[model samples]
Target: MATGRSTVFEDRSHAGAALGMKLSTLLPAGEYTVLGLLRGGVPIAHEVAKTLGATLGAVAVRKLGVPSNPELAFGAIAQYGPDSARHINEAIYRRALQYFGKDELESLERGTGADLLALADTFKAYCPELAGRDLLLCDDGMATGATMKAALDLVQGLAPASIRLAVPVASPETAAGLAPQVNGICQLLTPDNFTAVGAFYEDFGQVGQDQVLEMLRATQ
Candidate 1:
């Protein structure tokens, strides 16, 4: 059931705390890691990692959008690992390369070797070695799930035993679409009238790279 209307949570941290409390139940106790999408997913993932006693890291994902409308994301770019940095479909990326500058495009292709890189740096920092571990993918919410999907698809190659999608709130339709991609979906609130993901948060500010790094540092 959903409200079909937007409502704000206390803040990104509290929103994450609510979601993390629920995600902790699904995970088995072990040496696992929680990877958050940059800028938005970091705070939420940090709270979850704290609750589950897991390592906090970042996963890099870039939204593929229509050439004219860069904001409309059609898909995402998932990096291979922290240092692994492998991504699929270089051809498609080449098609979209014009949308970004050389360094920006290369950073996406290489995955972790960019400086002052805004969001992608998250994955490079936390899960540099992406193989042979349990990964819980956390984000604030999903509007279309395309970006999250791309991340999951790319991560599939690195071979995590289990991948989970955890969030505080999301569109019911989007959550349903992602159900098959991951091992489990633990979300607290689903709004039927889903628009932008930020609508559900009062303090929906951008999650900065340094902030994400700090969250990762705290867990370490």
Candidate 2:
């Protein structure tokens, strides 16, 4: 019952660490796996995995946007498992492509589908299988979730006993949308008027590939 001033949620890593502390108290005695949506998610997930004595792996997802308007996301694609890839596209990629130059469009086509398939293969080959397992999916924070929605859809194919989406903070709308798709959600803060993920965090720094690899190495 450490409920009081949660102002420390302002720090992304601190917020995530706090969330890990909270979840360790709440989860029941059972088997569970922690899967982080890298590369932003890896550090946060490492703590949870260590606390749970659970296996860890990456869930790679990419946002598909128009080549011209890379800022605008149309949908999300993810590498779920050895044989599962899923996409959730509320906005048509074609429309987003209008914003991109031809070169960027070709780049998108080249790097979209097959890359995710390879990523899924890597997740399955490198990490433990998640079938019928109680799984916890961790991330740095939530944006529109077009990318995460696709990742969760793919995780569903693994036939996990449950999928819990955990974040330190998120917008109420995003948390509400993901509620049905996930078995449960662990969000410490949910404000009605959310502008961006960074606004909630004090030190919203970049989590790059080097940081993720270092965390993985340390955990191993």
Candidate 3:
């Protein structure tokens, strides 16, 4: 069952811990895996992993942002093992690209090479033991959900028994959009006036590469 309600969180850690408590009471006792979407998702997943006593891993997804506003995403790419998948909002992508001229658009596409490679490396490093286990796909929050959508697509290819999306906060519309795709959902907050994911967090700092690697290493 997909359940959601509005709630406030102190920080990523607090939200993770609170969500973990709720999940503990809801999920049946069994072997489960906790896979956090890389960057911001890692911190929240760390707490969930600890609370649930599940192995932790990372799902690398890079959003293809609007050239002018990097925070707004029109598409995203997710990589795992040797495979990569992309999800694009063509309506937004077409409109957003108009801001950049031909030369700039070409340059932007070329710049994606390094990021795509890094996403592949991160996926290979963090993903293993994914088959035949109940999985929790987590993030700190979701706005447009393009990246998380990509993450979900990648994980589905791995043949997990079940996949549930767990996020600290998400807009009601985004939560509803994701509900039918996954087996279950655990969104602590579903604000109607959602502007961005960071707006709901007190300490939504960037998660560095070193921190992500260290968090994954600790689970192994």
Highest TM-score scorer: 3
What is candidate 2's lDDT per residue for 1-220, written digit by digit as tens? 1122334455556776788887888887788888788567777788778777778778877676665555456676776555445564535655555656557755775587767666555445335588889999888777777767777888888788989988876767788888988778887767666666677667777777666666666666
Against the true structure, candidate 1 has what lDDT? 0.71
lDDT of each: 0.71, 0.71, 0.81
Per-residue lDDT over 1-220 for candidate 3, one digit per residue giving the tens place of the 0 to 100 score:
2233333566778888988988899898987899888878887888889889998988777887778887788778887777667788777787876767657755665566468777668557777678899999999998999899988888888889999999988878889999999999998777777877877767777878888788778888
**Native-to-model Cα distance after best TM-score fit, residue 169 in candidate 1, in Å:** 1.7
Best by lDDT: 3
TM agreement with the true structure for every prediction: 0.78, 0.81, 0.89
- Count of clashing residue pairs in every prediction: 4, 7, 0
Model 3 CA deviation exceeding 4 Å by range: 1-7, 101-107
lDDT of 1 by residue, 122-175 (tens): 345466455778888888888777667776776777878788888888778879
RMSD (Cα, Å) of candidate 1? Answer: 4.7
Candidate 1 positional error at 110, Å: 12
Better of 1 and 3 by TM-score: 3
Query: What global local distance difference test value does model 2 have?
Result: 0.71
Off by over 4 Å in 1: 80-123
RMSD of each: 4.7, 3.8, 3.0
After superposing candidate 2, which stretches have Cα over 4 Å from the reference?
A: 1-11, 91-109, 114-126
Give the Cα-based TM-score of candidate 2 against the true structure.
Answer: 0.81
